[model samples]
Target: MSTYMAFVYGILYLLFTTFTFVFEDAYGFTQSNVGLVYIGIGVGMLLGLAVLGSASDKIAIGMAKSHNNGVIKPEYRLPALVPGGFFVPVGLFLYGWAAEKHVQWAVPLLGTLLVGIGIIVSFMCVQTYLVDAFTVHAASAIAANTVLRSVFGAVLPLAGLKMYSKLGLGWGNSLLGFLALAMCVVPFFFVRYGERIRTNPRFQVKL
Candidate 1:
């Protein structure tokens, strides 16, 4: 589920990182101005990480107190993913649609803010969840996920111009919106039945 959320968040990161050029061109903004928009995303992300990443641990640990189960249930880590999942598509759609329509520049700016918040929240959840769920192997797990995602992160921006050109912002972004919707289902699957899959001996112990 954490990896799934990362995939969704990763795509959004790609969307914004690649397509900010759209704002720069559409609004005829200066590079500094455009850089400020990117900076807003960076600032928003840092704020989220500072707050939510630490808070979620408190939340999980607090919830575990009631169960008296010495064990921290992976389910406790899920609440954070919920809002993060909801916002990614909404932000992307707003950003793309507003830009395409030539709405006030702030419309897209707001969308960027939402995208920033969503990505931060989702990432923190995934990182914290993986740390909790895997324990001894957590560093390896994070490293592995980081390597794959970093590769995607590096390549996705290069494709953005071609994709946006071919599809136009509306459809190109709509495609991403659809993908986000698909990603939203991942948490539900994991929350509903992921434990069974993880605990199955055949699945858990492997070469």
Candidate 2:
């Protein structure tokens, strides 16, 4: 789940940063006003936090209470991930095509809003799942997650200017959206088989 989250977030980070370019080139926003447009994403993130802040724990505790063994597994935290998975790709497609067609700025901003919601919800669930799964090793697991995401964040964007240039925002981000769509399966896989991975000797990490 951590590995998959890293890859997914890398793409999102790419989109987030690249939006500045989108605003400038596509919408003719000046440097001063570009920052204002980002409020849409901020609003979305806040909404995500508000919804998931209590809901994630409630879901986890409820599942644990209902479990035959009454023990909570980290997997319970991931069901919320399903919503985030959908938000991200759909948001990307909206943001991309909206920008390509030069729709209303609010349309693109709305797309960013959904992306923001997805980002925060996903981030929270991933971190919580890591903490519940690894306990003492949570920090290490997070460090690994951070490192991989950073690598992707750094490397993927280097291609942004070229990618957007060649593929255009519509197809460039759509390509990423499709990749993200495929990756949406990751959370379900974890929820279903996380224990098997944790228990299997070959899958066990050094930590």
Candidate 3:
């Protein structure tokens, strides 16, 4: 689940990194203007972090208080993904189709902001979930997640230009959005069945 979260995050970030080029080529924004436009996503990310990062813990604590005699389970952190899952695909499609159609610049920028918020929200939940689940081996789990995500982050952008060229930004980003949409199932599955999966002897950490 952590790795899958990372993969989705990697792709979202790749889109962000390449957004400057899109602004210039599609919207004819000057380089200076493009830099300014980036502030939208940056601000959006910070907002998401501020809001959702702390909310994950609060939500978990609240859940614990309600059930399990106040002993928090890792799965409690996963509910944050529900909102994020909805935002990401919506943002992606908004940005993609808006850019391809040459809509107002603010429209695409708004989409970028939504994507940024979605990324941070989902990322915080996944990070907290991994740590909560792995406990003694949390560091190792995080390392593996980082490596896989970094690999995807590095490789996916390499194809960005080709994808946009062939399909145009609309369909290209739609493809990425579709993938993110599919991944929404991942967290839901874990929330429902993670305890059983984690209880398997194979997942236990040896001292």
Best lDDT goes to which candidate?
Answer: 2
Residue range 52-81, candidate 3, lDDT tens digits:
867877889998999878999988988888
lDDT of 3 at 108: 85
In candidate 2, where is summed lDDT lowest over 10 consecutive residues? Answer: 1-10
User: For model 1, how does the per-residue alpha-carbon lDDT over 1-207 read when each residue is reduced to its tens digit?
Assistant: 545655664675567655457767788888777766676566657766777877887877887787646567776787767766767788788888988888988887777767677778877777776776677788988888788777666776677778888987877777887887778887777666766776778756343
Q: List the candidate 2 regions with Cα displacement exceeding 4 Å.
A: 203-207
Off by over 4 Å in 1: 2-6, 16-20, 66-70, 205-207
lDDT score of residue 183 within candidate 3: 85
Ranking by TM-score: 3, 2, 1
TM-score of 1: 0.86
Supply every candidate's count of residue pairs whose N, Cα or C atoms clash at under 3 angstroms. 0, 0, 0
TM-score of each: 0.86, 0.93, 0.94
Index of the highest-TM-score prediction? 3
Deviation from truth (RMSD, Å), model 2:
1.8
Score candidate 2 by TM-score against the native.
0.93
TM-score head-to-head 1 vs 3, winner: 3
